[model samples]
Target: MRNNKEVNAVQATKTADYCLAIIRGRYPSLAPAEQKAAFFILEHPESAAEMTSVQLAAAAGVSESTVVKCCQRLGFTGFSQLKLALVRELATSREGAFGEVEPGDDVPTICDKIFTATLQAVEDTAKVLDPCEVALAAEAIFKARRIFFFGVGSSAVVAQDAQLKFMRIGMTAHSYLDTHAQLTQAALLAPDDAAVVITYSGRTREATDVIELARECGA
Candidate 1:
């Protein structure tokens, strides 16, 4: 029979992966206190290892009860369990939360690293995306009378690419980088139109305004 230590070892690995997945997928839906705790754990995982629940709660500007409750919501029994899983995961992860561009890297090395990072990102995204959700989105696009691609910065590039893909399929599609043009276009949209806003990081307040405008216009 497997020993207690062996069972715990397995649980630890699963806990780390599971907790991170929950944080990523359910963060926006979490309460403000829980969101604070979750973001604290994500942004300062190493610090979390050394801090007690009270300390972490203070740092996150939440109560100790909130810390424990957040852990429970994240699928752990309590704060200590959550911390153990997070610390274990952080210990094993080599890459920081974001992608890194190292200094003194040669052109070929940079290219190789960038390509590898991109592949890893796509793989990670695929793991999180539900096939059913993709099917629903595809069906919605198919039935739309018109489509608008809305985004800015790197997400803008993604929006433009989507515009191109729909255009190639002979669909009526539009994407504008200019704020005025985007507002004007959105204002002209009707209930028959649809807007697809792509913001991977979920940090696009300006793009959100455009979407709100489109929504108000009955798009």
Candidate 2:
């Protein structure tokens, strides 16, 4: 039997992980309000902890209802409860906060700082890029008889790029944006085949369905 605080803590942990996963996978597809909420939480989590629903809504340029809804969607009871959980998460996670800039910084100086920050972001990303995972993916693709690429919107561009690269290398790769086309390809994918699901928001129902169908066909 967990107390309210304990239950809230557990929910917060789950919500934090869920939000991070969504931001990593489906950020590009987030609605404007959701995107703003996501970025605020990721970039300035400490501040997010102190914000009231109204203040946070103003910061994100969303309605208070949106803020409440976002909190509920993330598994918190409401804004206050979400803030409490955020505080706890921030205390435990050692992730660096994004540096803030004053409005007075000159353009060139700000540009240089932004450039340095971008480099740091790239370095951080590279630290987690496992070579073993790359090798495994390459092996899977190389040995598969066929490949289906799934993505939507901007991610669709990335999927198409992957398809083209594989095709240029003489692999049978197909990328689809339409529901019917994806369904057709997914239905045809076999146990000997593989599928590369590409979506920033791994939650896109249509794209995810295609990936699911591919697995159903034993890809």
Candidate 3:
């Protein structure tokens, strides 16, 4: 069994810019009560981050334990840890601004919000993305015999985009959006294969299963 250190390290390295994306990607796979908490968080990341587990429970209309379990289901140890992560993301995320959109807002206001939020999101992400991490990842990709992109939902589109770009550059790349195909390819990978899982939340059960299977096959 993995130790707490391993589990925490794995969970701690999740994407900071796309918590809502993550929630959405894995939302369909979560328990019903957890889905309620996820819905509350997606629409109210700031409020949810500031709330206690009990308060979140009240807001999400579920039990406190359900909120806690939701956190666990999303790869967090508990509410406070997830809350802190959300707060960090919120400070650097454009979704916070977009989350405040009202149904009655004008089209001009909506367009402006989207444009500015997208620019801000890019700028914020650039500030935090490490060049060393990019270099290491690139080196690994270059050394691999083949590259596989594993994703679901919107992330699957991202995987396909990546595959297209890599193939254009004459690289051996493949993307599997279908869960069954992803599992099949993962089971068939060789020792020198490299797979990048592209889910924003990094908590999708199907994606995680593919990664594990690939790892077991020495990918």
Per-model TM-score versus the true fold: 0.60, 0.56, 0.62
lDDT of 2 at 214: 81
Query: Candidate 1: TM-score?
Result: 0.60
Clash pairs (backbone) in predicted model 2: 25-200, 25-201, 26-200, 26-201
Candidate of highest TM-score = 3
lDDT to native, each model:
0.75, 0.71, 0.79
Off by over 4 Å in 2: 1-29, 39-44, 58-64, 72-85, 88-143, 152-154, 164-182, 203-206
Local error of candidate 3 at 27, Å? 7.4
Off by over 4 Å in 3: 1-32, 35-52, 71-104, 116-133, 152-154, 176-181, 200-206
- Ranked by lDDT, the better of candidates 1 and 3 is 3
Total clashes, candidate 1? 0
lDDT of 1 at 146: 91
The per-prediction CA RMSD against the true structure, in angstroms, equals 9.1, 7.0, 5.4
Ranking, lDDT, top scorer first: 3, 1, 2
